[model samples]
Target: MQHFLNSSFTIPAERNEQLESLLKIHCHVFPYPAKTKFLEYGDAMDGVYYVFQGRTKHYILAEDGAEKILYCLSSGWFFGETPLTLHEPTGLISETMEPSILWKIPYSVYDKLLDVNKLFRTAIMNCMSRKMLIMRHEIENQVFNPCKQRILQLLCSTVDNASLVEGKWYNLSSHYTQYEISTIIGSARVTTSKLINELCNEGFIRILNRKLQVSKIIYEEITDQMDLL
Candidate 1:
């Protein structure tokens, strides 16, 4: 697969050096190709991955064997925090969306490092906190927002130039179909396809060569409507 997520998402400025140092401390480093299943639900991982490069998705496979994406993680992020607390493997399967660079941390080593280094502890806390906040907003977006508005918000959060675009179009770098969009929005793909088509016809958004463009006026309207959702 040719993955296209933003590859240059850098570490937060305040902690860039700290993250680099952590990478230096790590004993295992692996490069994963796009579409690789990096980690699975309930599989033990000794170290949290410090994502030096690439993108990944967090999702759960249902009992019926359907995968549902919960979040997208880009560069500068880490995975495996959830399992750290429970002393078990994560329930979410992580798949590489881009060819990725990862520095693995053994659980015991990270624990010792965190105890010896205040920065590591702070980094973990900040990362987990941000995760929680994003998840909270996701729940609200899924539960209350209309499909169009939710799509608008998702684009706003992930896409660049969201505030200035005049047309109803966007080109997401990720490869996702209407079916995946429906799964994310908890709707049928037909409903999602219809909504997208309508948005195009109504001049709210448009698809051009697989690019998504949203009118600035419509974007504002959607944002306003979002508050009411």
Candidate 2:
């Protein structure tokens, strides 16, 4: 598979706008505050969702009840297709990370669009393809890479979603706690802390006011090394 360490896998803006316009007529738009757990494991999948104005985390609970983040969705991204298409209950928990607007298109509407709208069909297929690639990359990282490398890879993968601060350092757009970072990297909190400090000392990354930032040079270096690997 192609390298995906730095891929955000977001849909292109033009196609995203087209899809949004098409769904607007049939969707129920809702405003949600940060930390809204709108969908949970085993909930009936009544519709597909599109992010109009916020970020969300999609994850599953481990046997020990720990949350393992599968991926994050930003504005323009769509989700809930798998369970909806399969006529099964939701298998992942989806929660908003910030105050946002979302569109919920009923299953009947979604099905009709898939059958009648070529653009809609193509966009959904592309979304599924990208999701599969991301999952494959995550699995390979977990099985083949060390914890520290995995952590770096995660940071690299999020660069597109981060913002540049003072025109020099890229600040992670989302505020992630050490515990959350541990869960994402599949490591213990204490171990994650130590490794984060190690990365800081080596100039790979730094934390300011509890927000992680990486310099452009360091970001490029990490991506380069990842490419070689």
Candidate 3:
């Protein structure tokens, strides 16, 4: 499989030395299969993780056993910070969405790197702030956005913006089922299904096989509607 990080994203050069340092210490490459749980809710975290390939989901299990996805992350995204920072059990479950490769940096080495690497510290701080902002946006979308708008935003989030065909298509459905999409957007299954159909009818989105193809025109329309809201 192509490395998503190499295709459309590159790690910032400033953090290369820090990454190298971890490589020399406790960091090691690990592979995980789809649906494999790296950390369960309340499980103790042993380290921090960096995704080098494929996708993963950070979620919570509801009382009913349903997974409520908080974030779907691909290459360059890091995890295990909440537990590492608190020195406690993980609050959310982290699982693979696809066959994935990750670099695990044991907590002891993680602390050493943070103490000596200003650039790494800055990058991690920025990542944490971004994660918080994304959480806020997710909550706001669920509370205030219509199902159609919510779905549009969710689909757009998966776009490979650095690719040549970036805005023209998104392979979102390949990564998530309709039910999972509904859960992420906080919509009922019926509502999500109906809005998906409406989007297709309105020429706002098209699904070939499971890939969601999004046109620039539809993207502009979604943006305009969001602006109005």
Candidate 4:
């Protein structure tokens, strides 16, 4: 599927190495186990975080205690900048999805680097711009698209290119639970489950060994339809 909006900013290899070198010099590196809660709504943040390895989920809890997943940050991604820049408590909750190695750069050091290093500053700006674009697309999807479409788009976007089977079935990079899918699409778990069954019945998607896979033909067809809208 065309995933212009779902794609995150990936730093070029050389630049990424440079970033890691810089972080190693100025940041505190630590390991976090899976399901670790880094911060919650209204919690104070000490500094910005860089995902040296593994992934994290960032979301907000609603009044009804429903989780609304904003996005997932994988290796090479940095977060916690918004609250630091604004000098305010975080509104979103962040948790590591798996065992992770993170680099924490204190706010003062982060600020100083931005002021003194043009490459670092430009990279941060590019990352922020990509995030804003993704957020805009998510808002538009929630307001205008149906839950089924959203779910399909999300699944298609996660297709693992390296695992494509006979050039038809595309394996998903991650096996997402129904509850997780529901939160991401802002739908109830039951609704998401029902729609997922519908997709399976229609030969669009299937689960094998608890891992989701999408049909390439169906993916292209759905994305083509979306392109016309």
Q: In candidate 3, what are the lDDT values of residues 52-87, reduced to their tens digit?
A: 777888888779777677877777667787679889
Q: Pull out the clashing pairs in model 2.
A: none
List the candidate 2 regions with Cα displacement exceeding 4 Å: 1-15, 160-168, 173-175, 227-229
- Indicate which candidate wins on lDDT: 4
On TM-score, the stronger of 3 and 4 is 4
Among all windows of 10 consecutive residues in model 2, the one with the lowest summed lDDT is 6-15
Better of 2 and 3 by lDDT: 2
What C-alpha lDDT does candidate 3 achieve relative to the native structure?
Answer: 0.69
Clashing pairs in 3: none
- Provide the RMSD of all predictions against the true structure, rounded to 1 decimal: 5.7, 2.6, 5.7, 2.6
Cα lDDT of model 2 by residue, 1-229, tens digit: 0374433322222336667788898999989999899998899988998888878888889888888888878787789999899999988998987898999999999999999999888877877777887788778878998989887766766664357777767876455778877877788999999999999998888889878887778887766776677
Model 1 lDDT at residue 8: 15
The local lDDT score (0 to 100) that residue 32 gets in candidate 3 is 94
Can you rank all candidates by TM-score, best first? 4, 2, 3, 1
Per-model CA lDDT versus the true structure = 0.66, 0.79, 0.69, 0.81
Backbone clash pairs for candidate 4 read none
- If scored against the real structure, what TM-score would every candidate get? 0.80, 0.89, 0.82, 0.91
- Using TM-score as the measure, which candidate wins? 4
Off by over 4 Å in 3: 1-25, 161-174, 224-229
- TM-score between candidate 2 and the true structure: 0.89
